[model samples]
Target chain A: MKYLNKSWIRKSSLFILSMILVSPLFAWAANAVDYSEPLENAAHQIGAIGEGYSLFSGIFPEYSLPGTNIVLDTAVAGFFGVLVTFGLAWSIGRIIKKGNE
Target chain B: MHIPDGYLDLWLCGIFYLLTLIVLSYSGYKARENLDEKKVPLIGVVAAAIFAAQMLNWPIPGGTSAHFVGGALAAILLGPYVGVLSMASVVTVQALMFGDGGILALGANIWNMALIDVFVGYLIFRLFKNKNKSIAAFLAGWIAITAASLFVGIQTGLSTIFKFQLQTTLLIMVIGHGVLGIIEGAITASAYRYLIDVRPDFFEKSNKKEVEA
Candidate 1:
């Protein structure tokens, strides 16, 4: 918990927070519809899955989480994405570093 | 922009996949040669930050939303090759976990966003850094994205399934991204300014290593 007070962590958190604040969860800005849906549908005729066949597809609606509250879902999803991204990059970096060493 | 499935034909997707593979292989080789243990955490943090920031979508006038694609910022902070890897991870995750993009079109998406965006941004930043770093950062963000958009326009326009003429798609993508790129540039410059102020040691070390190498 003490690590939370670190300057970098604090700064990073603020930046991430600012991003989430601007997201559709807050409705501060007009949410743009994905214009690709028509193209995706056209591709579907040729066996394309469009949005994707992933389990989480459409559940998050632009990568936000699913929950009773859309706002909380978006915030939680953003934070979760950050953690996952950090972990994935860190793991890859470590592997690359160790491979070189 | 995350391209969904069916946007590109399989043949084009395959070609882009091979291209992406070649670039990523070279980037991995470069990373192995140049990466430092001390910088590993920074890569993770930068990737994470980029991923988070990408979720913030800014509305464009015509009801289309544009989000910050942070490849330029990543390249500035972590060098070009490492920046590609960071962005690759972010794009890969977005496709795989979130299904934000089509699995079949993933290769093309990566080629456009991760490879083109990062390298162009890095080259632009390096080209003009001595003139004015902040402006250089801004231009890097602006031009790199526009360049990437050119490719997206080409890809979608060339595909038979897309239904838009090549000229029309090209104009729309380039012009739209060119305008949205200003916002991107401002954000990149601001973030670069903030990071440099807070983490001068990181840039100093990165620059010193670049000079020595």
Candidate 2:
């Protein structure tokens, strides 16, 4: 029992220490992936829209029905996103139930 | 929200991963305490179900797709500790089998989605427990998922900001997750409601313990 307990403690401590050492490297890699330049330009252009200035105007801003803004698009997107998630959850539930039976 | 490879600061991801591991370990202990040996199969089946469900992608409004992260639902059914463990299992399997999320990102993903959504969501549900089960479930599931998604979004935005443009990345993340949040909320609500009808036994067990207490 003593040996087992000591081994467990050593394993746990090692796991903790390794996590501490490895986490920073992951964060640095994440920081490197930020797409700032293009996003900044996009935000700037979007901010300029109310000033009667146009960028990417010829692309037909209304992809769907007329007068639908980004908010509406987001709402629409969210609605479907929820549906998909629910379907997945339910299907998983069904499978689990089946497997158990 | 499924965090990609480069979404969070490495340090933040590491911290989250450690935190998740701690929570998961604790939760696993608690689950072992509460459940009998016979329950293991049921839990395994449930975990598998959640794992498979999480992989199914549905299209969102902006031509993007999102999947289920079943933290809230698990908590609602199995209690918070068990819920978190179940979520951890699902996430671990996904990372290993499907490569849905990054290995390093697993910690953050589980913390943001599983720990937050399950525990926080269950707390909220308990708050509204006196009113109605279905309503409480809906509210809990909806709020929990939205909150988790937002947390993920903010983390993503911050990571992006650390490297690139702060404001733009924040804006994109917020907008993307805001939409994602609504979807998460709706799906959580629907699923919770469905389970309430089908598996009242699971929900009832918690209620019985409370009443017995």
Candidate 3:
């Protein structure tokens, strides 16, 4: 038990220390006020729902639609993204499972 | 913590994309080697859950809303390889289909949340799970989320394209995320307990060939 405790302590410390070393690379923000906000806006404009897939949720958004709102558009995009992922995963899963069986 | 497009310098984005691609490729290789057919669809479902969970933000104190990233939970439940793959899939879809993150910033987001958080959380849990499961889960979630914030703060702070003081943003990001990380830890730990109660086979490494444990 003593030896096991020592081993865990050593491993935990090492992991913690590595995190500290990499801490400088990221700081998460719940709500951010930074230089990036304006850029996000610009990107959204560039990635308008009608435009090509430029990284804003694939074309579910309709910022310029006659009655569309950005929030709704975003949610629509989220829904689509979820569906696509699940669909792909489920299909591939079946294929793999069948091969194994 | 998705940075919209045009936030980071295009060159910086390029670099991050390259790095993310390399890391993701390695993760794919690992998954292919270790994963079994039975668990493949679960990865997809987990990714879908994470992507959906991120959209549901509840108000935290100080006018901020916090949402589940699910990186830690995925790692704890699925192991590192599957966790990373699921997260990567979630991140990719969020970018491609929902535009949750900037196209250019997708790599950075993946680097922070998918790669760093999942790896850190999984490694910690694997290390300490035998002794104290709750502590392992809690610590894994906390560190993973906190580290993700730190990673983003550091990048945004250091970037010349953004005219913000690195110290201020870094401090705010760290402190803000520090508070949120607690919630993340609690959620992860509780979720682990619940899942174990319901799906003990998922954790029984000896019983399942597909599981990462």
Candidate 4:
């Protein structure tokens, strides 16, 4: 009973108040995303999974290769994007370690 | 979020590239000075994870969607320099392989996403972490992306080639990233909490931790 004091109560109240204030910031600014096409395409072919919502497309617009092989192109780019980045960083880290030694 | 090519003038491009080079070199130096074999693999895995995560998009409250930019998460987990290095790696790969960002603007993207996000996220989280880990993470993610967006807006405004308005660019960039930052923060806090619980060793043995201490 003695442990529950005024300062503790104030702190708890403030935390709750702050949380209430923050929730609306998220609520106010949301926009609608068109998921209809993605949903429709995903139903037709397994390749559709590699369509509009690709890992690389949003960041790199040039990645939007408009061809019959769009799926293959995007997939290859996405996988290689990870591989090349990993390889480059790993090599740099390795070099620095060796230099210090 | 990747600015395509032809947006920046040659001089602006050079300046951004130079800054990125300096930071990249410095980070590499710091990482090497206390080289650990495990950290190399760790860096690779984190970079790859970030690149993969960037692919997935989450819808915002509005009609738009935003994806994760793992800069802050990397900074909090690995410390700022390593975080920058990790992000730089991701940006570089996207430019060269996917043509995701413009080659000229690539440096600027790295500056914004990697440099600014990592440092801001690390600093903000460190500042408020004593209060609550989740809140700190949220602020880190939110502010880091907002700050990165500001930098991009400035770069676009600065370019003599582009007729972009600074205020409008800044507004759109900030608002968009501000929303996205929340997602980034939640992802960071959850992922980080999981990591700290399961793989605390990664932090304990990190070169940045050793140096900072």
Candidate 5:
């Protein structure tokens, strides 16, 4: 095993542990009554089959309008936005670096 | 839990939207500080890749499907600020173009998923970076996602609480997100490994310094 950074590892583990402990408490306090049923049911369903296929059908219901156009538009726009932003950021970085050099 | 339109109190949605904008703008500023030109194209490419990946939803067992959230993974691969911005961009485009999430609830969605997932998750991942690169990466990716998923659950619970339907919403969000978390973790770990192998420089700490310089 790689010699781990003891302090870093300890801190990370502690932080995660704390968050894990604190989150449930926050959830419990946030709700006055038990709200575990729907989640349990959903879990049961996911557990029985698998995650991959189930998510598709669940989020995008068949009964709902086939919003294929919307989906495609979102996907396309997101694609280009990321592409453009990245290009701009990268080109600017190169320019700055050249100036520095 | 992409809160649909008219699900939550409008007041709450507005409050959250403002909060989301503030946090995202701040993150954007931070990202700009260290961002270099070379990395810009790469970031965009990665964002596109994440967008494509999210589109390819595999079916989950429980009459639902789950896809990569990519927020935690992005935070892990890039830094938290960049990750959150990337996610926010994705969310923004999705809302505006596809109407997947409520326009009013954009703030809540971004805060819960993008901010919490990316910023908090990456912070957790960085904490675990003990040079056991693989294990650290796995845990960081996995745990960060799990935490984010739970936050989404809590957000739902809060929304329902206001409506006196706290039990139902909380349950749905928690359970749905819990399972989703596992898928997220696996995908994140795998993706991180793949990226590290293919583009070691991208994951290198020195890259940040290079940008800053």
Candidate 6:
């Protein structure tokens, strides 16, 4: 039993460590890059939406809040994005599982 | 690539939406039939991880940037059907909350990123797994994006809003993604290898075929 517990803890720690390593990429990207510019340039004037819409528009570079930085906005967005996505997927999976039962 | 609203005509949008609806419905049915309860949280975790990973965009030489699209990774971890649902959740969240992709083009974006990427990647991985598992994963990630890009090229090429010809869009989307897909392939391979090492039983339990490999 103790061996199993140690294995589980080790696995969980490794997973958490991987996530930590991956999380820094988001911060680096938020600080260094403008996510929208490349898409806008690729889409051209004809198709580019150019930040006129979206619930979190203010968090982006085009319509950022007065006191907020793009890095902060991106971090906030990333945090919420993970939460919402997990919730949605969990709900969908639960529904399917219940239906199957 | 997230397709913006004006990029595709309403007619194209409608068609893709219809297609997405059909595929998602079938995927749902399959998930209900095959998915285990233990796998549910795995789905959520995978979706969340993919969503967070997408924020890391590597700027390409042309005007655009590329990021890791984990459809292949999802499909490899969860089978194709559940993988579709996982990716669909991520895409939907990105559109509604972040305005990452256009509202009108949500269907097309789901079609490309969620549907084509997951299905094609799964197929490639299965086909090539017998030879080498890591190389199979690499090809899955690389070709899946390229195939998804082909559809984007078609949709944008056909749309009246975009001035680019079919050939131009095809060349741009396909070649550009083909190059960037190397990074995606490496990431997929590395991630798969790590997961296999840490939780070998997880993959075995997820799919019987994974046990064979």
- Give the clashing pairs for model 2: A26-B10, A27-B9, A27-B10, A77-B61, A82-B183
What TM-score would you give candidate 1 relative to the actual structure? Answer: 0.87
Q: Tell how far residue B40 is off in model 1, in angstroms.
A: 0.4
Comparing 1 with 4 on lDDT, the higher-scoring candidate is 1
Error of 6 at B119 (Å): 0.2
Clashing pairs in 6: none
| DockQ score of each predicted structure, in the order shown | 0.37, 0.03, 0.15, 0.17, 0.07, 0.37
Candidate number 5, chain A TM-score: 0.34
Per-candidate TM-score against the hidden true structure: 0.87, 0.61, 0.73, 0.75, 0.66, 0.86
C-alpha RMSD in Å of predicted model 3 compared with the true structure: 11.6
How far residue B159's Cα lies from its native spot in candidate 4, in Å, is 1.7
- Model 6: lDDT equals 0.78
The candidate, 3 or 4, that scores higher on DockQ is: 4
- lDDT (Cα, tens digit) per residue for candidate 3, span A58-95: 45432112265444443445556666766655554455
Q: Chain A in model 6: its TM-score?
A: 0.48
lDDT of 5 by residue, B3-64 (tens): 54544556777878888888876766666666655555445445555654554444443334
Task: Decide which is better by lDDT, 4 or 5.
Answer: 4
Model 2's CAPRI class is incorrect
lDDT of 3 at B52: 60
DockQ of 3: 0.15
Proportion of true inter-chain contacts also present in candidate 4: 0.39
Candidate 5 structure quality by residue, lDDT tens digits, A4-87: 246534553453334333333333332333232233334344442122121122222321225454334333344444444345
lDDT of 4 by residue, B1-213 (tens): 776666667799899999989988887777665556656666766787787666554554334456778888888877777778889888888777666677777888899989999989888988887899778887888888889988977886676655556675566667767776777888888887877775666666562463464
Give the CA lDDT, 0 to 100, for residue B18 in model 2.
Answer: 83
Can you tell me which runs of candidate 2 are displaced by over 4 Å?
A1-101, B160-175, B207-213
